[model samples]
Each structure stands twice: as structure tokens, then as C-alpha cells.
Target: MLDTDTIGYLAATFTTTAFIPQAWLTWKTRRAEGVSLMMYSIFVVGIALWLLYGLLSHAWPVVVANVITLMLASFILLMKIVYK
Candidate 1:
């Protein structure tokens, strides 16, 4: 049988890590000219909801990944506004 915990951690970590570079680039460059604020706003909100769901369900993988992603996404969104 597949280990759900292991799968969750791996998938979450990979997806969340994939987002890091884009987030870091946006923050470092402060040029989100090509990025869609509306898209990211919705995405971040969705991630936040996922995080909440993870917490309620006591899922560490979901919780950890979404929390980090939330921070990164929120940072980029803020930079998008501030730098614009």
C-alpha cells in the first residue's frame, strides 16, 4: 500500500518549491509587470484556504507547504503593488 504521508510530503514540497523561484525573482526584481495580480490574489487566497483545511485535518504536508507558499505569494503580491 502507498504511504499517504510520504506522498503528501513529497508532492507538497515539490509544488511549493517550484513556486519559490518565481516568488523570489519577483521579490528580488520588484518587477511584476508581466505577472497577473488578479491571478496571484486568487491563488494566494486558495492556498490560504488549503492551509486552513490542512490545519483542520491535521495534515502536516499540506500545512507546511501552504504556509510557506502563502508567505511567498503574499510577498510577491505586495511587491507587485508596491513596485508598481
Candidate 2:
């Protein structure tokens, strides 16, 4: 059976990894015209708050996932800005 931390990390991996394709595609295509700036703006903020929460709670999985997710979300947001 997986431990709590293991499970947490697994969950984190899935959610965080899920964004990679979108980030990569945006980075490569330089076309975020289809992306919504308002959504990403809100998403980045939410991810930052999640990172803070993870830090306060000492949840390594959450911290790591949120950090990476934040980066991806921010990158997407930046792409949107640049491409818009």
C-alpha cells in the first residue's frame, strides 16, 4: 500500500504533469491567442496561494507541484501577453 506522502506525490505528479503539454505547445508555437488571459491570471494567483499553503503545512508534494504549476501557468500567461 502506498503511504500518504507517496499518494500525495502521485497526485501531485499527475496534476502538475498534466500542464506540461500546454506549456510546451505554447512555448513552441508562440501562439496563445486561444488562451484566456483572465483565466490564467486567476490561475497563477491561485497556484501561488496553494504554494504558500503547502509551505505552511509542510506538504512537500503540494509545494513542489504548486511551484512547477505556478511556473507553467505564469509562462502561459506571459505567452498570452506577448502574443496578444
Candidate 3:
């Protein structure tokens, strides 16, 4: 049986790795015309909360995932602000 930490680790890996490409694309393309500022802002806040929770829980996977996600999301949010 898979342990809880193992599961979280795997889940976090997939979830985070999934975003890196998109973030890289967005970073390279610098396209935010179709993106919504409100949505990205809300998402960034949520990710930040998750990061905090992950820190409090001392979950390595959660912390790692959230850090990357927060970085990506914050970049998108910044693009939203700068573009729009």
C-alpha cells in the first residue's frame, strides 16, 4: 500500500510538473490578452494559502508544489496586471 506522504509526493509532482511547461510558455510568449486578472489573482491567493498550510503541515511535496505554483501563478498575475 502506498503511504500518505508518498501519495502526496506523487500527486504534488504531477500537479506541479504539469504547470511548468505552461509557465514556461507564458513566460516566453508574454501573452495575457486572453487571461483574466481576477481569476489569476484569486488563484495566486489560494496557492499562497496552500503554501502556508503546506509549511505548517511540514509536507515537503505540498510545500514544493505550492512554491512552484505560486511562482507561476504570480507571474501570470503580474502579466495580467502589466498587459491589461
Candidate 4:
């Protein structure tokens, strides 16, 4: 059986990777017309908070996932602003 942390990491990996396609599409197309600026703005803040929470709680999976996710999300958010 997989350990709890292992499962957590697996979950994190899946979720974080799932966002890659959207980020890639937005980046490649250089258009964010379908992306909502307010939503991405809120999402970036939330991800940042999650990263902070993970850091404080010593959750490696959370830390790693949120770090990557925060980067991706922030990138999307920036694109949204710039493309708007």
C-alpha cells in the first residue's frame, strides 16, 4: 500500500499537471480572452496562501504542488493582465 505522503504526492502531481495544458495553450496562443482576469487574480492569491500554509505545516506534497501550481497560475494570471 502506498504511504499517506506518497498518496498525497500522487494527488498533487495529477492536479498540478492537469493545469499545464491550459497554461501552455494560453502561453502559446498568447491570448487570454477566454480567461477571466478576476478569477485568475483570486486563484493566484489563493494558491499563494496555500503555499504559505504548506510551508508552515511542513507538508512536502502541499509545498511542492502549490509551488508549481502557484508558478503556473501566476503565469496565467500575468498573461490575463497583459493580454487584457
Q: lDDT of all predictions, in order shown?
A: 0.88, 0.93, 0.83, 0.92
lDDT tens per residue, model 1, 1-84: 669989988898899888788878987787889878999899999999999999999999899989988988898888888888
What's model 2's TM-score?
0.96
Tens-digit lDDT string for candidate 2 (1-84): 899999989999999998899999999998998899999999999999999999999999999999999998899899999988
After superposition, the stretches of candidate 2 with alpha carbons farther than 4 Å from their true spots are none
Greater lDDT among 1 and 3 belongs to 1
Candidate 1 segments exceeding 4 Å error: none
For candidate 3, write residues 1-84 as lDDT tens digits: 999889988998888777677667767888777777888888889999999999998988899889988987787778767766
Task: Tell me the tens digit of each residue's lDDT in model 4 across 1-52.
Answer: 9998999899999989988998999999999999988898898899899999
Model 1 score (lDDT): 0.88
How does model 3 score by TM-score? 0.84
Residue 73, candidate 4: Cα error in Å is 0.4
Candidate 3 off by > 4 Å: none
**How does each model score on TM-score?**
0.91, 0.96, 0.84, 0.96
Return model 1's CA RMSD, one decimal. Answer: 1.3
Model 1 scores a TM of: 0.91
RMSD of each: 1.3, 0.7, 1.5, 0.7
- After the best TM-score superposition of candidate 4, give how far the Cα of residue 6 lies from its true spot, in angstroms: 0.6
- Give me the displacement of residue 35 in model 2, in angstroms: 0.8
